[model samples]
Target: MNMVEHPGFVLWFTGLSGAGKTTIAVALEAQLRERGMRLERLDGDTVRQGLTRDLGFSKEDRDKNIERVTFVAKLLSRNNVAVLASFISPYIAHRDGVRAETTHFIEVFVDAPLEICAQRDVKGMYKKAFAGEIKNFTGVSDPYEPPINPEIHIHTDQETVDESVQRIVTWLEERQYIPAKVTA
Candidate 1:
């Protein structure tokens, strides 16, 4: 198949807030860009300010947020643009719904224990959630539904960003969604 002539796949990275979902996605995006592939990223924090500003952190709001992002990803992927999404979409139903919405979807579970995520929280989300200052926070007050049999699973706490990105890249290459690495 001519990957360049066909629509690209949707890559969904899901995990806790500090589980390095965005970090790995950003690194993967950089790697994809370096290889001359056209891709777009839709991050939770970045989209919340625009696409989902009216939504809150409630369960319904979270589902709606995922729906919106999935809608956008569907459009882009249909047009041959690789849509990379980094979200703490803590619901399995919604994630599955997103998978159904795209032509090709890869669910990447960025895994890290809650303790490690808490330690990596630079925004103090974990601290605030632990202190009762934040409600409905995944891995704290709220719940996180880990991906069941995800396409790729990366333990961010156990791997560096580059390693995580390489894992994702390898998956894409194996499926021919992106070109394989060329040797010098």
Candidate 2:
């Protein structure tokens, strides 16, 4: 079967912690890779360990983090690589900056209520934040500005991971960013 070649795009996932951004990105990445798409995943946790290791969670640091990631995403997406970035990215200005810098940018708001996110926190981050152990936590001490008009929005508390992935894939296909899957 012949494969469809498409231009590069950035699928940016943004939400508060434990809101299922990474989960959906991981599933969507698997699907895209299976379809033979060249892909890169720039996750917040992994990026912080390396690219933004020196940065704290201050507003300035958050901006710098997204700025660096945006630079990388811009280069890769323009070169026809699918860039999947999952970040808290709590500010609208930073996200808008990335959209302006990248090619075919698609913002995905993975939304879940603070209570739901806290319940889903396997890393105990929410617990610590509630206990005053963690400062500058989004949805807690820090502000997380929800996307005013994202390309896609998924409510993790309501939708299953598969449902969320399918929604994104369908959107991409509809927009011709990715061709519809061929079934045997």
lDDT of each: 0.88, 0.93
Instruction: Please provide, for model 1 over 72-157, each residue's C-alpha lDDT reduced to its tens digit, 9 standing for 90 to 100.
Output: 99999988899899999999999999999997999999999999999988688888999999989999999999998999999988
In terms of lDDT, the best-performing candidate is 2
Error of 1 at 122 (Å): 2.1
* lDDT computed for candidate 2: 0.93
| Candidate 1 positional error at 90, Å | 0.2
lDDT of 2 at 23: 89
- Scanning candidate 1 in windows of ten residues, the lowest lDDT window is 1-10
lDDT of 1: 0.88
